[model samples]
Every structure is written in C-alpha cells, then in structure tokens.
Target: MTSPPRPEPRSRAAGGPDIVPVSPNPYRFRTGRVVLVLEGVLLLVLGVWGLAAAGEGTAPPAGAAVGPLQLTTAHAALLLGTGVLAVGCSVRRRSALAVVTAQAVGYAVLFLVGLVGAAHEVPTVLGFDYGDAVLHGGLMVIGLGLGMWMAGEGLEGLWWERRRRASRSDDHHRSGTSRSPS
Candidate 1:
C-alpha cells in the first residue's frame, strides 16, 4: 500500500504566504545558472567581434590604461573565457552560490574601477570619450539586486536545517546504522 500524504514544510511566520519548502538554495541555483549562461553567450559574441576588429587592424590600442580601467584585447578575452567557464560549471549544477558570490565580487571591483576613472578626465572602458563609470555603476546595482533576491529566499533557515540533517547522518554512520534488514 502507498503511504499517506505528507504535509509540505511551510512558512512558520504568521500571515505569511504559503510556500512549498524544498532545498535551501533552489531558487538561487536556477537564477544563477540563467545569469551565467546569458553572460557567457553575450561575452562570447562580444569577444568574437572584438577579436575580428583587432585582426582587421581597426581595433583600439591594446592594454592602454588612460583610465583606471584598461580596455585591452586581453581584457575582452578574459571576460569571454570566464563567461564560458562559469556557464559550463553552471550547466553541471556545480558551485552555483560560489559562482554568484564571485560574480558579485567582480561587480564590486568593476565599480571601483569605474570610480577611479571618473576621478580622471580620460575616457574609461568604452573608450572614444565615453566613460564606463555609468556602466559599471549599473552592474553594481544589478549584482546587488540579484544578491538580495537570493537572500530573500530564507536561506538562513535552510542552512541550519542542512547542518542538522548532516549531523544526524553522521550520528547514524557512527552507530553503523546505514542499512536495514529485509
């Protein structure tokens, strides 16, 4: 016979909307994957275009640091390569939070770079009298928004629950109770 229906774990807060509780970071996992994949594709296209322009002798100066942020072929290649690797890992569903965390850090760094450029008169990442201070500023905002969404998913409770479950599993293993008799 089939077992009886089980109650879904739900919001403990009074007046909170009902939710079917699952793992600690399912939402982040999915969102992070999407973000990484999209970034990867976009970067790939941009990198190819940049490299083509460079080959045609119409590319901008390589590794020029007029502004705090340097616009170089290496920089574009690095961005594209990082995008590819991140997307590959995300597709395998590995280290999602770690990747997103790193991305957040990257955004913060870029923001600082943009700020440094703003302090100078020279143009920044876009070059040709255009400064990247605004673009990086926007990236900073987007990154923070993503982080807030991830945190709003009630991850703290899930972390504690995972620790408890792991402890229980360890206890069982210590007691040599990994299996049951038929």
Candidate 2:
C-alpha cells in the first residue's frame, strides 16, 4: 500500500519555511573536546622541544625555551604524559569530563608546590620556575573551568538518566503489565 506524503511546515501568510530557533549552547558538547585536543597538541609540542633541548645540552640553568614557554626535563615529562592522556580521553565518548577534572587537580597541586618551593628556596622535583608556576596556574584554571562547564552541560545527567531509567523499568515490572505475543 502507498502512503500519502507529509506536508512541509511553513508560515501561512508568508508561504515560506518557518524559522527554527537555535539553542544557545549549540556547541556545548564540542567545545570542551576541541579545547582538550588543542591543549594536548600544544603540550606535546612543548614536551618534545624541552626533551630535545635537554638531550642536546642546550637547556640553561633556569630552563629551556620550548616555544615561548620555559620547561625543564621534569616539566617536559609531566606535559608529555598529561598531553597523551588528554588526547586519548578527548577521543572517547564520555571520558573528557573526568580527565579534564583530574588534570585540573594535578595542575593545581603542581602550582602550589612550585609556589612553596620558590618561596622557601627549596629545590622542586619538577624544576618549576616562576614562569612554570604561572603556566600551571593558567592550565589549572582552564581545565577546571572546562570541567565545570561540561558538568553544567549535563554530564551528571548521564548518571542520573541511567538511574531514572532503571527505576522506571522496575516500576513498570511491579505494575504486572504483560503483553500478549502476536
């Protein structure tokens, strides 16, 4: 049997297609992921540069300039490890929020450690200088902000939705409704 085609939605007086409204946060899901990837790539490049400078014996007492930023061997290793992890999580469907949050905490700790070490004139394990501390603080803020934004954009809904659906299923089963096989 053939069916009739559905009519298109239009404005009656204008005889034109109706203008659809767009959501304010149209790119909510994509924004965090894109930022993560970009940051990851930046970190990777800096890490490689820092490593190269260290290997070539060109690193100074303070640190080597990886692009505009200064980095030591320890800093380079930290960047490289986190960069790889960030890139990996960004590619996954739902891991971005968790990874971003974790990275933010890690950066925050490093920032504090750098500040304390510099203040007490104690040697830091990560060889953090003033610039490195500033960089870490910035990264920590970015990651934390991104994670919070994602959470506000319904990251928690994933967990809540699952629980809601499971409860609904249980309620349905309790109702004792049965369907006859056709």
Candidate 3:
C-alpha cells in the first residue's frame, strides 16, 4: 500500500517565490558583486581625477596619444559612467567578465602603444607617474587572470544549480506527484 512520489520543481517549487537563487554557494554572487562595485568606484575616482587635471597646460583635451593609443578626459568620464552602470547591473547580471575584459583591453592598448616596439614619452596615467610601460602590462595580466577566475567560478556555480534543480525534478517525478512549473 505504498504511495507514489512527486516531481520536484525546476528553478522553483510550485507556488514558490518568483526569484530563486541559482547557486549552492551564495558567496559566488557576492564576490562578483563586491568586485564589480569596487572596480566601478576606482574607475569613477580616476575619471574625476582626470577631469580635475584638465586645466593649466594639461595634456590637451583629446588626451595624450602614444602611437596608436588615445586617452581623454571625456574617455575617463565615459569609463566612469560605464563602471557605475556595471556596478548597478551586477546586482542581477554577471559583470566580472565584462568589466575585467574591458580593463584588460585598455591595458593591452596601453602596452601596445608604449611598450611594444619603440617607447613613447608621455609617462603618466591619471596624472600619476607610470615609470615604465610595465605597469600596463601587469594590470592587463591581472585583469585577464581575474576575468578567467570569475567566469569559471560563476559558471561552475550555475552548472551545480542546474544539476540540483534537475535532481529535484527527478525526485518529484519519481514520487508520482505532478511536476511543478518552473
């Protein structure tokens, strides 16, 4: 006189909350959020600093160009705004990869312009002495590494969540209950 089991829900149980967490490890999302916010704040600070450095023989409005690389006060402001958006979006979206990738590209361009072949002489970034082009190269490497780590961790979390949900579905289905709507 045994009874049948029920199929568990996918993403959420029947009549469950509309928004469900996607990871067993809650810290993953938190990490992504914190990192993005910090990065955004840094970018905004740099942007404001660049704007403040705009007057009195400041390196032209178009920013100093090193070979093929170009930077401007406007660009900094744009980046700052982008950072802010990234931070806000990160509350619901994965922004680590996007933000880090952008930073990586910027660093790469700087490296190419100043360290690739012959050296160019505008040795500063955000009005701070950059000593050599090595800093750009280093930052590029760090960004790339961080991006990879964040992507991998986030994706792994997703995979596990999906598997867990599927397991619940199987359990519910085996138990003979109607499968809950996802």
Across 77-171, the per-residue lDDT of candidate 2 in tens digits comes to 88998888888899653588778888899999989988876575545566676777888899899899888876663543321111113466577
Report clash pairs, candidate 3. 4-175, 5-175, 5-176, 5-177, 6-172, 6-175, 6-177, 7-172, 7-173, 8-172
Evaluate all candidate structures by whole-model CA lDDT and list the values in order: 0.55, 0.73, 0.56
Q: Name the lDDT of candidate 3.
A: 0.56
| Highest-scoring model, lDDT | 2
- Write model 1 residue lDDT over 8-84, tens digit each, in one string: 54454645444554456677757856776776676576556555554565555533442333445655565566566
Total backbone collisions for each predicted model: 0, 0, 10
Overall local distance difference test of candidate 2: 0.73
Clashes of 3: 10
Clashing pairs in 1: none
Worst 10 residues of 2 by lDDT: 156-165
Give all TM-scores, in the order shown. 0.53, 0.66, 0.51
Better of 1 and 3 by TM-score: 1
Candidate numbers sorted by lDDT from highest down: 2, 3, 1
The alpha-carbon deviation from the true structure for residue 25 of candidate 2, after best TM-score superposition, in angstroms, is 5.1
Q: Name the candidate, 2 or 3, with the larger lDDT value.
A: 2
